[model samples]
Target: MIDSQLSRAEDPELAVQVQRLHQLKVCTRWLGVIISWLVVIPFVTWQLQEEIALMRDHFTLAAVRYALIFNPISAIAISWCLGLTTAVLLWQSGNILFGFSSRYRHQLEKQVRRIRRRGKSHVFWRWVIGSKNQ
Candidate 1:
């Protein structure tokens, strides 16, 4: 589908713009993941401080094992969820900062329609995309 779109785009500048938009999307996603992980790590550590202190004081194999297993697992799960919010914010900000071309706008509207079809049952759908009336 994208290949067809690219083939149909005769203007070199339009192609370049589309490519840059794609790159921006990819970069924002990765940046969101990094930001989420950075935020979550310190937060999770703070929340688990008591457990960490107990492990430090006792120095048991079980405590060490639990710390190794649980902290990262919980942090990752939390950060993975948070990353979506950050990514959406970042992407929206990018769109605002760099206004979309007509071609991009059409593409974005199509994507928005697809997202709207997912309905309010999706956690982020209503907040991010809004209702059909809006």
Candidate 2:
């Protein structure tokens, strides 16, 4: 679909802008999937409970006490750690991987604004809803 659009574009600058927008959209989508997995994997796993049981069985009182004290703190710590990791990775990818400097970001924003005013609702809603259906 984007290929057709790019092929049909009369302006070279517009073609490049569209290509960049498509690349950024793809990056946003994959980043969302990666971050969701990072945020969800730890809490969703059964391994933690098994490990807690192992500690209780092996180390008895000391492990149980430490585990009880540490569980909540660890959950909070893990959440913050994952969040910061996500932010850092996103920044790194934007800067290094995607070459998305602030200037290109502003250009993308302006292009999106232009699209919005042109009655193209898909541009605004695509990232929010993760849908291509218009």
Candidate 3:
């Protein structure tokens, strides 16, 4: 599935993401894991105290966007917006980072292919074996 170039600095394929590299299914699975851990967990554990804490934290901003002056429904709504915003931010930045790394992988792939084409196979094999040392 890994059709992109990977850098020597950090080939996820060479490490944690090795087996799952370049697979849409892997992304989906990972996203599902994150959502379960982050969104569902806290939501399920939610209580009235936590809701009040949320209202207290955003008390200043409420004056501007809301006028009802704090209720259970408003507290829940504010907390949800905060959680959703954090998730969306993470997703967007993660996407950008992956896009950049994919490009880097493509560049590395081209470089490797170029060397393989121009350099003799025996030479490459010798280099891999560390010359006389190995």
Candidate 4:
């Protein structure tokens, strides 16, 4: 997408808008990742502590085994869920606040339509670009 946008860099106005949108997207994505990790680390730690405490008396290989196996999986799932949710929310809020070019809006609406076609079962269906219906 950036590549396609850059190709139109000859148009100064478009170039600037694309640059601004790109920067916003990048910042929001990283912020989402950081927020996800911040939440996941402590939550996962507390979960592990609680599980270990509960199994302290009858501590067996199975408890440790399951923790080792499931913790990472759960952590990854939770992180992706939180990260994507945060990113989408932040992106939409930014769009509402700053607005975007018609080209960008069209692209976003196209993406939202594709996601919507995937049905409500799609992970991002709920947050699929807010400007879509507009």
How many collisions per candidate?
0, 0, 4, 0
TM-score of each: 0.42, 0.34, 0.25, 0.40
The reply for model 1, stretches above 4 Å from the true place, is: 1-9, 54-61, 64-134
Q: At residue 86, what lDDT does model 4 achieve?
A: 77
Candidate 3's displacement at residue 38, Å, is 24
Candidate 1 vs candidate 4: the TM-score winner is: 1
Better of 2 and 4 by lDDT: 4
Query: Which stretches of model 2 miss by more than 4 angstroms?
Result: 1-9, 46-48, 51-113, 116-134
lDDT of each: 0.63, 0.58, 0.47, 0.62
Output the better candidate (3/4) by TM-score: 4
Please identify which of the two predictions, 2 or 3, would achieve the higher TM-score against the true structure: 2
Model 1 misses residue 90 by how many Å? 19
Q: In model 4, which residue pairs have backbone atoms overlapping below 3 Å?
A: none
Candidate 3's residue-wise lDDT over 35-130, tens digit each?
Answer: 645754454345344544666777655543343243445456556656765775676577567653655445444544453455555343233222
Q: Write the per-residue lDDT of candidate 1 for residues 48-127, one digit (tens) a residue.
A: 78778997789798886676577776656665657677767776677679865566756744544455577666554544
Error of 2 at 37 (Å): 0.8
Per residue, candidate 2 scores C-alpha lDDT tens digits across 29-134 of 6677577667665663443676567775696776755654657655554566567567756865776776655565556646654764555455544543233445
Q: What is the per-residue lDDT of model 4 for residues 1-134, given as tens digits with 9 covering 90 to 100? A: 57545545544443444444455556767777777778776776676886678578778888876776777866575657676777677877876798766677556545544655776665654444333354
The residue ranges of model 3 lying beyond 4 angstroms of the native Cα positions read 2-70, 100-134
Model 3, position 91, has a per-residue lDDT of 61
